[model samples]
Target: MRYHRLTPAAAVLAVLTLSATACSTKSGTGTDTAGSDGVKTGPGVTETTITLGALTDLTGPYASLGRSIVNAQQLYADQLNASGGVCGRTVRITVKDHGYDVQKAVTAFTETEPNVAALSQVVGSPVVSSLQQEIEAKHLLTLPMAWASSLLGNEYLQVIGSTYDIDMVNGVEFVVRKAKLKPGDKIGHVYFEGEFGENALAGAKYAAKQHRLSIVEQKIKPTDQDLTAQVTALKQAGVKAVLISAGPKQTAALVGTAAAQGFAVPVLSNSPGFAPQLLATPVAPAVEKQLHVVSPAPSFSSDIPAIQKLAKDYKAKYPKALLDSGVIGGWNAIAVLGEDLKAACKAKDLTRDGIAAAHRKQSGLSILGVSHDFSDRAKPSTYESFVHKPSKQAAGGLVNVEPAHAVPAARSYPLPKS
Candidate 1:
C-alpha cells in the first residue's frame, strides 16, 4: 500500500458528547418495545442517538479528495445538530483514516465496529471490495465512493452517484452531440488498468458503437508519472477526441503532455480527474483551454441556492480551502444519512432495528434539487446518482450543463465490444 505522511495540522477532529433523554412511550396500538433478542419492537424509533462511521483517506494518496469529503460530512452533521437533530435525538459521526489502503480499510472497519451503524464514503474500489463481505455479515449499510460496476448488485452497498462507466458514456455522448461529430470520427482513451480505467474504456467503446464512431487508439497502464507515450499513441492515431479516467496527478500529466505534443483533441475526464487543484497547478492554463470534465453535481461555482449556501458556509468555516465537487458530494451523502436517521427515529423505540425499518420506508426526501424516495422495493437505492457535465461559466465559475441525465443501471448504455 502507498503511504503519504499527513501533516499533523491536517488531522481530523472528533467531537463526541452524550446527552440524556427520556420520553413516554405511546401505549399499546402495536407500538415498538425492546425484546430479549436486542431488537426494538415498534412502529419505528422515536428519539435515539445513531452513530455513523466514515472511513476515508484522510492521510493518504487520496488525501485531497478524502479530506474534502470529511469536512463536508462534518459540515452536514453540524447543520443537522444545529437544527435539533433527527427526531429529537442527536447524530454523531465517527471518522477514521483508512490511509487509502485496502488493508488499512479492513482494519478501520474492525476498529469502528463498536459505533458503526452504517459506513459512509469508503474511498477506493479495492478497499470497498475488501470490506464487502464484512459489511454484509455485520448488516452494515455502506455508501461507497468507488463506482465500479461490480458493486452494482450488492445488497449492502448503496452507490450514491453515477458510476465511472456511466459518467464516461454521458460525457462522451454530450460532447459528440454538442460538437456534432459524425460517423468515422476517431476517439481515443487513456486510462489505468484496473476497474476505474476499465469502466471508462467500456463506456467509450459503448458510445463509439452507438454513434458509429471508432476508437482509434487505447492506452492502458497500472500507473505512470508522464503520459507522453499515451499521448503520442493517440496523436499518431489521428483521433479527434480523447477520454481520460485517471487520478488528478496523472490527469495533470496527460494534459501537460498532450499540450506539449500539440494534440488538441477535445478531452473528457472522469470525476476524480477534474480536481480543482489539478486545474490550479501550473499546467492549469493549458488544461483550461483544452479540458472538459463530466461532473456528478453542479460546478463548485454554481449560484444555485443549495451550492451557494454550502459554499458560503464552507468558506466561512474553512477559509483556506476552496470548495470542490468531492466536498459537495460528501455533504450530500451526510445529508441523506441525516434524513435516514430522522425517518428511523420517528417511532417510540430508538434502536437499530427501528432505524433500519424507518430507512426501509423512506419516501420523498429532498437534498438540494435531487429527490430520493426509498421504499421496501428500493432498499439499496441511492439518493443522488445522476450524471452532470461542468463547463466554464462566463463569470469565472463552473456550472452544470443544462438537462443533467442519469443512467439507472450499468447496462443502461450499450456494452462495448470485447
Candidate 2:
C-alpha cells in the first residue's frame, strides 16, 4: 500500500525492474548468489539471488507514489547488493503496476506471486483490502505502504508505519494542543469514503472522545470534484478545527475552500495530504497559515544522521525523483527486510517462513528516526507521528510543529479487523 498517508506521488511503478545479476554504471556488481553459508534456501532464492515482487500503482492517481517507492527499492537493493546482499544473495525486485485499480492489483499480485519469495511493497488500500483473503491464504510477506488500520493485525503484512488510524490520534492530539481547543469545542472531519478515510475517522473519534471534543463529520467519494458543500458544513458547525483524511488534491480543496470562506480554522491532515504541489496551489497561502500534516516518517531534512545519510544517498541515486516522504516507506521496508533476512540467515532458514518468524521477534526496532518500533508484533505496532507545518522555504518543505508525538488514544481504539 502506498502514499496513502499523502499523495496518490499521485502512485507509479516500474522502469527499474531489477534483474538478478544486472550491473549498472551507477551501482557496481549487482546480485550474484554465493552458497548461503550452510543456511536453508527458499523458493525465490537461487545460488546468487533472491527475487522479490512489487505491486504498485504506476499509471494512476498514485503513480507518483509508486515511482518514488520503486526508486527507493532499487536504491536499497543496489546498496545491499553492493554490500554483498542479504545472506549472500542479491535482491532483485520485479514490479507490476496496478493503476490504483483493485482488480488490476489483484491480477498483478496473482501473476507475480509465484515468481517471488515475498513482496517488497504493495501500495493501495482498497486493493489490499480486497485481497486480504488471498494474502492470508497465500501467506504473502509484504510491507504494506497503505495506511489503513484494518490491515494492522495481519501477521503477513508487516506495515511500514503506524496505521492511518493511529496517526490520526497523534494528529488529533497535536492539533488540540496547538489550537488550545477545550472541551465542547467542535472539530470537523472531512474524509474519503474508503478505508484510509475511515481509519482516520476512527482515530479522530477516539481522540475526540478522550479530550471531550465534539466531532462533526462528512464523507466524500474518491471522484468528488467539489468539496464546497463539505467545507460549508464544517464552517457552519462553527468547528474549532478541521481534520482532512484525504489525498493532496482533497486537502488542497478543503483548505482552499475553507480559507476562501474565511473560516480561519486550523486544519490537520493525514499523511497522504503531503504533496509538494500543494505549495504551488492557489491554496498555498492558506496551507502555510492553517495546515498541519501527520507523517509516518521523518522529513528528508531530519537532523538524525542515519536519516541524513539516507537523504543524501537517495538524491545521488534518483537525481530526478522528488525528495518525497514516501521514500521512508521503501527504506523502512528494506531495513526491516534486512533484519528478517539477518535473523533468517542466523537461524539457517532463509525461507518465507523464516522471514515471517524473524519479524515476529522484532522489538524496539526503529528506522531513520521517524518509524516507530516493530517490537511486540503479537500486539499492534506502536502509534507515533511527526506533526509537520508547511512552509515553502523549509528544507523538505515541512517543518515539525511538535516533537515526535505518540498516540495515547490508541489504547482506547479497537484493533482493526481484516
Number of colliding residue pairs in model 1: 7
lDDT string, candidate 2, 1-418, tens digits:
2232233233222347554332211111112233437766555666677788888877888877887787788888888889988777777888888988888898887667655667888888877778777766665678877867677767788777777788888888888888899999999998889788988898899889999999999999877758999999888879999999888888888888988899888999887876766887788999999999887776765687887788889888766566776677777887778777778778876666767788777776767775455655434556667888888876566777775667667666775666
Give each prediction's root-mean-square deviation over alpha carbons. 5.9, 5.2
How far off is residue 209 in model 1, in Å? Answer: 1.1
**What is candidate 2's CA lDDT for residue 341?**
77
lDDT (CA) per prediction: 0.64, 0.75
Best by TM-score: 2
Candidate 2, position 262, lDDT:
90
lDDT of 1 by residue, 1-418 (tens): 1111222343444331212122233312223466443435332222355557788887677776776777778778778878887655556667777877888888877766545456657888888878888776655567787766567655456666555777776777766865578998888888888878887788778878878888765555545767888889889888888888887677778888888888876777777776655544677777776777775556655556887788888777666665676677788777776766666555543444444456556567666655655453222243133333333332122445543465443336643321
Worst 10 residues of 1 by lDDT: 15-24
Error of 2 at 65 (Å): 0.4
Error of 1 at 236 (Å): 0.7
